[model samples]
Target: MRQKAIPALETLMSAARTIGNPYLERAKKAGRKIVGVLYDEVPEEIISAAGAVPVLLRGTGSDGTELADPYFRELTCGYTRHTFNEILNGKWDFLDGAVIYNSCDHMRRIYDNWVRRPVSPVYSFIYAPKKGGELARRFYAEQIRDFLHRTEERFCVTLNEERLGAAIRLHNEKRRLQRELYAMQKGRRIALTGTELLLVMMAGKSLPVEDYNALLRKLIASLKSCAETFEPGVRLLYMGAHADEPLFFETLESEGGQIVVDSTGFGEQSCELDVREDADPFEALVSYYFEETPAVPRKFGTAPARAGHLLRLVKDYAVDGVIVTRLTMCDLWAFEQYMLRPVLEKQGIPSLELETDYILQNRGQLATRIQAFVESIRSSRGS
Candidate 1:
């Protein structure tokens, strides 16, 4: 009966695509300005306050990365290369403007290239402070103020605390609803397949939080009466980013593995985290920064801690095997993958490692590997 959930999961992905596409369409129809945020540094509040929608742009599928090879070296992360490819291909032509943050050297160079040859004419570079020292804090504050001034001058929208707070409240409400949905999954009140949850979480980057929350709430309510029995399957815990794609989970399920928990940003990143109204917004931002597991290339204090934390999660969740889906060109995850594999294996845990693009075009290969790995684990258990 696990196979029966595939259609329902596909329906979820279809709904997410519809929701994300309509926002782009509405912006085009109304001629309302829209800006692409390169990474997580573009504050959702800033975009909301500026009267422009913030679309989180990332690389997906092989098609999006065709041109990126010439722009970014093969050694660079595939995500960055694919992002440039998307721009070069005019896939992001609908954007009225874009904000690129200097989060890392590669991303900084991308920002430089973007400003020089923008797909959209109104691109701006925002330098994100790397150090959390007092100087860095002051620098970032001034940068935020300057960015707001430029945004107001260009977009003719003032950034006020009230508007910012409202945006925060909206995001907070969305988080609450997402938490409810996650609770349903945790409690087995509904059996949402892994890929379905990944699609839903990914939609958060493009869709309006309020609308997505409503859809998720409706979905939860619709599935509240689901009384499916959990089959005795190899419980798995996923620890990487590329597993955020539903097809990855579908492949694992097809191989007789069930993902019971995930350590992906999509699964746990923005959920249950709230920006307190009374606290300084910048401080709140800094606090949120501290709370997040560092993405690739910025792994100072986070990697070892995240490794330990994930190990604990694996034990607690009763996961039989760990699947690490390292994204192609993501050096940080590659390093973490190396560190994590031996540690999990040393503990007598079976693990599988797979590298993938954000989109799942090579499902046949992935399925074959997963099936082999699951069979190996099952046979070992029997022996």
Candidate 2:
């Protein structure tokens, strides 16, 4: 089932690196609406069932936050700052609507500032619970149902059970293919560098489900023949926070480390679980995000579960070490690192923690630390 020298990775990554690709343009041109989503937990299957493209938005195209600086406080992390910059510049003007979630304090600023803008998408807010329990599950399901009704009424589409089932199956397939793509790296040689994989992951979310699934099928089947190249180094599990730019992963590759696996945003966290095909679609969606997937640090009482998840990944993937990176001002992930450090150490996993901004202006400094960490891992393992 493998093909020779398939030539689609570059095309897919090119589309991923930018905001709107030809596929996105084509979708818009066809009168299909694009709905922007800020969090991966935002139940995109519902968006698709409502006949819209659920774009996981990022600020890669932002040049500066001059447009954003005046409206926000200094403590808002660089991630949201650049996104606000892009918003003011009209990069995301293509969205017909947007679904915002209460991801953190920094992200809450998005809904507030975005509402005041004259030009913005019709909005729907999601309140994903920070805890796991039956009461929390009931509340989230009700919220999703409310979201569904708002989407249908706002977007003028009917979401029947059949449509919901179809959407769930399509997204579940995308999940399976994405996980399969990640599994391609479990061996000694990796098909692509961590940077390329980040772009691939980014690309997967940028396009429609069908198109992305096709690209993944081709890439997985023909990885040996893909045109891209990379050198594998110590296998490290890159962890924590939302970073859209490939510069972070590119730097890791340059420092003699291939992020063979990661727990970072747009990494393993997005694809580790799939919704049930047999259950009520809404209940399945609630269960998948609220219960099945490992709770992140932001979720209440999840530290032990998160630590166990990391430990299992290291053992499962043969990770040489772990690197925990977070934005300079992200309170949650800052605490996540502080809490998880002891767990990683108690297990004897060599690790590095870096505090960075969205701009990555301190690459030289971060790279120095990474070089030492890589050497330390090699020395300990006698590699």
The candidate scoring highest on lDDT is: 2
lDDT of 2 at 192: 68
Cα error, candidate 1, residue 50 (Å): 2.7
Model 1 C-alpha lDDT per residue in residues 147-179, reported as the tens digit of each score: 667777778877777777777677777778777
Which candidate number maximizes TM-score?
2
lDDT of 2 by residue, 190-299 (tens): 77667777788888779988888888888786785565544466888888787877677778767788888888656677888889998988888888877887677778
- The weakest ten consecutive residues by lDDT in model 1 span 290-299
Which parts of model 2 have CA positions greater than 4 angstroms off? Answer: 1-6, 224-231
Residue-pair clash count for candidate 1: 1
- The RMSD of every model to the true structure, in order and in angstroms, is 3.5, 2.5
TM-score of 2: 0.95
lDDT of each: 0.65, 0.83
